[model samples]
Structure formats: C-alpha cells, structure tokens
Target: MTDQPQVSAEKPSEASADQAAPTPEAEAIAAYLLKHPEFFVEHEELLTTLRIPHQRGDTVSLVERQLKLLRDRNIEMRHRLSQLMDVARDNDRLFDKTRRLMLALIDASSLEEVVIAVEDSLRQEFQVPFVSLILFSEKPLPVGRWVSTEDAQKAIGGLISDEKIVCGVLREHELAFLYGAEQGEHVGSSAVVALTHQGLHGVLAIGSRDPQYYKSSVGTLFLSYIAEVLGRVLPRFTQSSRPVY
Candidate 1:
C-alpha cells in the first residue's frame, strides 16, 4: 500500500518566516519619524543624546550640531551686513563730492573757469589721475584741447557716436588721441562719455593705472552725470566764441 505523501513541516515554517520578516529597524524608525515630526518635540531628551556622525570620524550630539549650524549662519549674515555698510559709506562720500563739483560748475564764469572746474574737481576732489576733456570744433579754441570735427571723427568716431558711457581698455590710437602719446601709453583702462545736449559737444574721458578699474559701467555714473552738466555749460561758451560742427 502506497502511503500518503507527507508534507514537509520545515518548508512551510521557512516560507512563513520569509513572508513575515519585519521592516529594517533603521528604515522603520526614519519613516515613523518623518511621518510624525512632533515625535522629537515629545521626546526632547533624545536631542541631547542622539549622535550625529561628523566629517572627522567622530560624532556630536544633535543639539551641538544644531548650535554649530546656527553659529555658521550668524557669521555669514554678519559678513553680508558689513559689505552693505561699506557700500553705503562709499556712496555717501561720492554724493558729497558730486555736490561740490556741481556747485563749482555753476559758479564758473568764463570758459577757462569752466575747464578749470572740471579738471581740478576730477583731479583733486574725484582723485582721478588721467582726465581729458576734448572739444569738437571746426577750428581750435584757446582753452582746453580742441580738435577739428574731422580729426575727432577719425580718431574717436566709435566713442562719440554713442550717448552712453563707453568703458574698458581702448585702442592705442584712441588713447593717444585722447591723452598724449606718452600719457596714453600709461592708461591701462578708461571710461569715455560723449558730451551731448541739443547738439554734440565733445568727449570726456578718465583713465586709471589698473586695467580692471574701468572694465564696465559700474563706476561711470558720476562721469556721465558730469558730462551732461558739461554739455549744457559748454554750448553756452562754444556758440559765442568758436563754431562747432
């Protein structure tokens, strides 16, 4: 007689064990904590006892790590505040200097005084080393550098065409034309502005020894403002004395 096939009790028990395996301890804890963040608030003692691994192979209490993060953020915020304060101070000084220069221009009576006002303020008050104010005319004037319209067009045509401030390093010939050959060679970077109002007046340029100093429009606001004042003031004198094309 064939006996009934006997079922293996071990196989059934093993399958049951595999199916009933619990979630990994660490994963279960993390998931539970994520779902109920208030768990930490209820068990405040864990904050002092929980260890967080540090980069240096040691561990620190969660509370200590939190304090360190707060300290780092405080330092970063302080640095930003300091930078903003520095910029504010600089702008205040610039505004004062600009106010003085505008007053001087208003007080100027003759074309000579006007030229002196521009040159002296830019050199002494503004602390600019290289400055050039070239007037465009059909004939050369006695005061300041005056170039025939043709010569100016040939030299700084690109610079004078734009009403905006032109900044960055300039071509050798352009530099030579604005400043003298010797001085132009020393100008590493410059900002040029075309003096224009009802008509084109001239060009005003300032140069620095540092190549990166005038690389953009960052600091050319004062220069452009000064140029506008000059454009209005200059026409008053030029139209009376020399004709400008």
Candidate 2:
C-alpha cells in the first residue's frame, strides 16, 4: 500500500500545439468560391470589401481591379487596330504602284524599252535606289546592267535558284557585279527575283542604300508578280530565230 509514483500530466510541445490548432482552409474556401461565382453576386457587399494588391503597391477593391483590367485590355486592342490600319494603307499604295509598273511594261515594244521602263518605274515611282537586269541567254539584250548567263553563274550561281525571290544583304562580290564598284559599295540591301519563262531564265535585282530596307522575312508577293510579268513579256521581244545581241 505503499509509495505509488505520482503521475504528472505534461503540456503539449509548441510544434504539437501548432499542428493541433484549427487553421483557416484558404485553398478550400478559394475552390468553393470559384465553383460558386454566384456567391459573390448574392453577397455583393464582399466585392467592395475584398482587397486585392495592385501592381503599384496599393490595395484596390475587386470591382476596381476588374475595371483596371478591362481598361488595360481595351488600350491593347486599340493599339493593335491602329497597327492594322497602317499596314492596310501601305498595301494600298504598293498595289497602285505595281499596277502602274505593269502597264508601263506592257506598253514597251523591245527588250531594251522594257528594261528602261522597269528601271525608271522602280527608281522614279517605287523609289528604289539601284536596279539591275541579268539575262541568261546565249546573246545579250541591248540593255544596261544586262549580264550574260555565264557571267551571272560566275558571280551569283548559288543565289539563282528556281523562280523564288531572294531578299537581304548581299555578298561583296555579288554587290560589285550587280551594282558596279562605286554604286555597289553604297548598296546595303537588295532583292533578287528569278525569271523563268518560255526557254528564258534571268534575274531582276533591286538594291537600296539602307541596310534594313530589305529583310529576309519581308514579303515577296509583289516582287514575284512583277517577275512573272517580265518573264511573260520578255519572250515576246526575244522570240527571234536568231539571237538579238
């Protein structure tokens, strides 16, 4: 009957107390609110009371935040619309110039005249600084900048592929051959359109002084269309049984 050991009840550790405390179920509450968005509509008062941190280190009501987001999206949409309008105006001007050039080519009677028309239109109308025409034929056309097939292959053999248009900065040798020593030195960018039609093959090269004037990613639809017109019409002037040197 003796001395029984007195048992003392120990207090829980700090870690155990923290773990046992009832924590706010923030994630669960958020999920519930997302699932039932109508809950906000029913409790309209919460919209005015709910505070959201703004990008500028200030708190705003949920309704104010929503308005700010809408305003930002509206501004972005207007900027995009303005860019689209600018592009449309540029396309319209280009189309008009292309039409005039095509008409001029159609009116020309000889290969030399066609060459003059092209150079004049591109320089005076299209504002291109430099232009060159290279024909791949046994006999050369009586035109300035017209190079023989052998000469073209020797200078830019790799560049002359099927009938695709090439645009961007050109190599030093290519620039020299296309624009000559003095002018080529100043040319920073160029576009070369391949010509292939009715046993004829050639290239139409255009150059500009600005390095960024022609880029690899620039559209070549108009250049290709102009080349096609040249191809079809050039044969008409060079259909002689004997070569026109």
Candidate 3:
C-alpha cells in the first residue's frame, strides 16, 4: 500500500488497517519518488515505465514552454489540454449541486484561494477523507502549526530536506477509512503530480484511505488535468494589473 499523506478528519480502511507497515519496496519507491518527483517529467528513460505516452510527453514539452499548440484545431496535439479542461469543468458541474459551490471552486483569484478550492473539490471527487493543497516555492512556508500525521510528515520532511522528493503529499489514507476503529499498519494511498515552480505547474495530491485505492497500475490523466488547471490559474493571480512605474 502507498503511504499517502492523509490530512483531514477521515479514517483509514479495514483492509488497510490490517496490512503491515511499509515494506522495503513500498517505502523505497515512495522515498525515491519524493526525492526525484521530477522523474515523472524529466527523466526520459522512466517515461515508458511510468506509462507516460510519447505524444503526451512531447505535448508536455511544448506546454511547459507556454506554447499553445494551435497548430491544428482540426488535428489536435498529441495531448490536448483543452480535453482535460473539459473534464475539470464537467467534474465541477457534476459534483456541485449549486452554482455558488462551482464558482467558489473556480473563481480563485489567488494562490491561497486556489489551494483551498482544490482541497475541497479534489477530496470530494476522489472520495478521500482528508486532503490539502500545497504551493511549492524556493522559499518555504513558515512552519505551519499543524502536521497531519507525525510519522508521515517526518519521513516526507526528511526526503524534502535531502532533496529526495519534489513536493509533499498533503493527506493520509490510513486515517481516512479507519476512523473510530483501529490503528492499522497500512495507511493512505496518494495521487501525486510534480509541482514544478520552474515549469509553471503544481502538484495535485488526491489521497484515499482505502487499501484498494490508487495503484502503480493506475493512470493519472485526471490528476494531470488538475495540475494543468492550477498551472494556468496561478500565474494570472500573481500577475499585477497595475502599470509599472
């Protein structure tokens, strides 16, 4: 099972509760990923292993440079971000019963607003007990008073300090489904995106408390959509509208 950062008020699942604590492979893989999350995008060799399509890779290459692939509306780019935006919009409309909730999710005018909106929408969409939205920067956030799970934070913090992982996962799976029950060895699973400040993209962490949650075998197209949306929104918020004197 993956050791996803479980934040929020939910509990871990029964099957997850029963499984033993992190195995060497699971721990190593998680740690390795945390350190080199860029491997998700940068390492060309691991692209196939991660199942990132070649066309998507090339598209990402162009997207990272902020080049709108308008070469052919008739012939879409290998990976179409417009398609992903359509998914996000549909997701927003589907889950939100009222219009205000939908507006709150997308009317984000700043990074903090974006984080809060994403935390709510994504946790609900992924059916997770807890979730968080993290903004990565060369500068660190003043040590926030809360640490979701002490142990998970410790492991992740270590990797971050050593530059092992790219960004932190904000929710825990173990607690999501296991609430009001027992303390299990297994914990939350996570859906991760590498939030690169340089690339103008941020990670979208969707976590679950179920043992059967996110697997290495699963695809992350939706999570990619989430990241892509944030990538577009954040800069607009930061760009000053006032004229430079």
Misplaced by over 4 Å in model 2 are 1-59, 240-245
Q: Provide the overall lDDT of each model, using Cα atoms, as 2-decimal numbers.
A: 0.83, 0.77, 0.46
TM-score of each: 0.76, 0.71, 0.36
Off by over 4 Å in 1: 1-58, 240-245
Provide C-alpha RMSD values for all models, in order. Answer: 11.1, 12.1, 32.2
Can you write out model 3's per-residue Cα lDDT over 1-245, one digit (the tens) per residue? Answer: 98999789879899999999988999999899899867655644343334222355434552332222233433574357778888788767654533443466478665566666666565565455545444433343332112222333333333223211222233344233222124322335555553333342233445455645666626455555555556556545543211111
Using lDDT, give the best candidate's number: 1
lDDT of 1 by residue, 1-245 (tens): 99999986655666686775566996799899899977866765555556665454365545665566667778999999999999999888988898888888878888898889999999998899999989877765779988766778899899888688989999999999999999999999999998888777788999999899997688788777888888888887777323234
Prediction 1 TM-score vs. true = 0.76
Q: Output the worst ten-in-a-row residue range by lDDT, candidate 1.
A: 236-245
Model 2 has an lDDT value of 0.77
Weakest 10 consecutive residues, lDDT, candidate 2? 236-245
Best by TM-score: 1
Error of 1 at 220 (Å): 1.1
**161-206, model 2: which lDDT tens digit per residue?**
5567788999999988878888899998998877767544578889
**TM-score, cand. 3 vs. native:** 0.36
